[model samples]
Target: MSSPFSNTVYVWQALFLREALDRFFGSRAAWAWLLVEPAMHIGFIGGVWGMMRRNSMGGINIQLWIIVGMLAFFLFRRTAVQTLHALDCNKAFFAFRQVRPFDVALVRASVEAFSMFFISLFILGAAAMMGLDVLPDDSLKVLLALSGLWLFGLGYGLVTSVCMRMVPDSGHIFQILMMPLYLISGTIMPLRYIPLPYRDWLLWNPLAHGLELVRLGFFSNYHTLTVSFSYLYYWALGSIALGLALYRGLETRLVTQ
Candidate 1:
């Protein structure tokens, strides 16, 4: 027989998983919308860039390159967005003693991660259908890079969600700040194309490092010498530590509010 604590944990996990699945697939349109949004964005961006540059950018196919970068970046962005609002969205659930705010955030992150994975596979399939090369040079490296990005996003979301709870207005500001990061993080362009000083500055963004590592895996000829997994790992670890500290210290206040 399971102990009370173990049973409670199991119940909470089941509840969280059910809630996440419902939110993601609650309606027929929900899943479609999730897939369509990324597809449309990738399409527009890839189309314009493809028209502008008939040749490969940095010897990487523009369409495939942009799609991979966008998908990888979206994994982080979507996870963060979902997680930041998880607490407020699931506030009522806190009435159940076993359902903590952290559980809600974890569920949201898991759902986003699950959604992003399929979305990426779909995008790669579509790209292949369009005559774009979709295979990775190093599949293991690609998986590792994506896993790192997901961890980073989850950590970032945990911190930002707590901040949003403390200061509601900060959510809008955070979204605005993320807008510039998309451009600078090499989602639309390769890091190699950027000149020295600017590239050095851009590398400071851990997401940029994640993106470049992902590109390195995708393009056989692409050489990414500057990206350091250690850099991304540290950012993820630090953010998660800080977020957990804040959450643990303020649990009662956060839940009550």
Candidate 2:
């Protein structure tokens, strides 16, 4: 059902993905450390939160709440960071005419997406084994919300990648900005915990809505009346369009650099 050109693209994509993974993991021991890091992070956060609040937040299991939020946030952050630096990071591969900067970014995004999928499964499975409720009440909704998060990150990455390519130093500024965005996006705290006027302002962030939708899918009783799927989609689509437009305009400079 696929044309030769599409199949050739697939082959290049796979090769790039493998190269990215190799560069990321570096060794078998690094892979083991990667698995341990998330577990420790989740444990520390969950343990601290569990001590402070004995009951579930909004009737969702505390561990599940943290894990879901963390995974969604992590996926976006990881994908964006990877895509943002894809060009400069893999510039050596550009020696091949088939390996465009866009291809590098695409391969980096694909690698992060695939890595997150497996990492999420491991976290959820580990939580389930620990007797936490790791199952989603609405699987389809969760899938959509998570997919939106990834797509949004991919789009945002495209824009940022172009920006970074144009101005290499901007990458550092973007990394610094991501910290506050991560906290405000409700990675460690639920929106319900925030007081009135502040909650209204945080809701303006599209990622906050995506995180809320993720929670909505995971917990039957959990509900966020403020989340707007349309708003999130608008930003996601807008970013992708703008990024593509910018990339096309600067493709010549990007390829030369």
Candidate 3:
């Protein structure tokens, strides 16, 4: 007889493959579109910023800065969005008693992280060919920062997904929040450009801290507001903990609703 642990392993493996296929091959040229969408956004933003004739930021290529920063930010956003919708999309799969809502959430979030890594790599490689420095000065720092951001984003999605599932209309408010978040998180605009006092207030935003840390990791000379992985992780862990509790308490509803 198969043990419970073995059954879970089998379920997770199957879920991963199913999610990965749907993500990369669900649409015609789906994989190509994934690569192209972000590339276009980075290029257009970099070009517009380039017109300002600002070549370097904190001693690194401004375009490269934009590329990496945007990539980091996108990783978080994509993971959250995918995880938020995972339950609804995988409702049919819940017919299998072994499959659970949390299972789908974990699988979908993992797929998004997997996709972002390749997308970032492809875009960065293209930037290198274009002669922008695409190498990180502190690769470990970069990795840690990116990982922290992804974790927090996943946690955010998990918590909000519960909110969304409970009240379908709540998803609209969460969707609206992303726009203001993008503007304030320093993805397209540098935080330093924002005046003092207000900028200090922005630092209270975990995304802002995550973004600044990512930039510091990429450029040795980069300087921004002081950041704390602890601060970011606190939010990450807290949200994930809350989300898991909600899922545990309301698993049947998540699958049914």
Spell out the clash pairs found in candidate 2: none
Model 2, span 145-239: residue lDDT tens: 88888888888889998989889899999888888988899888877789989999999899999988999988879955579778888888898
Worst 10 residues of 3 by lDDT: 56-65
Candidate 1 Cα deviation (angstroms), residue 128: 2.0
Task: Give one digit per residue, the lDDT tens place, for model 3 in 113-211.
Answer: 899998988888988898878788899989989988888888989999999999999888987888898889988888888998899898888998888
Best by TM-score: 3
The TM-score values for the models, in the order shown, are 0.93, 0.92, 0.96
* Model 3 CA deviation exceeding 4 Å by range: none
Least well predicted 10-residue stretch by lDDT in candidate 2: 15-24
| Candidate 2: Cα lDDT at 10 | 79
Give the Cα lDDT of each candidate.
0.84, 0.82, 0.87
Per-residue lDDT for 1-257 in model 1, tens only? Answer: 88978966786678667866786779978878888988888889878886886557667777777788889999989888888888888888899887777787778888888888888888789788978779898999899899889888888989998999999999998788778988999987777678988888888899998988888888868756478888988998888888888889999988998
Between prediction 1 and prediction 2, the one with superior TM-score is 1
What is the model-wide C-alpha lDDT for candidate 3?
Answer: 0.87
How much is the lDDT of residue 156 in candidate 3? 89
Error of 1 at 120 (Å): 1.2
Q: Which pairs clash in model 3?
A: none
Better of 1 and 3 by lDDT: 3
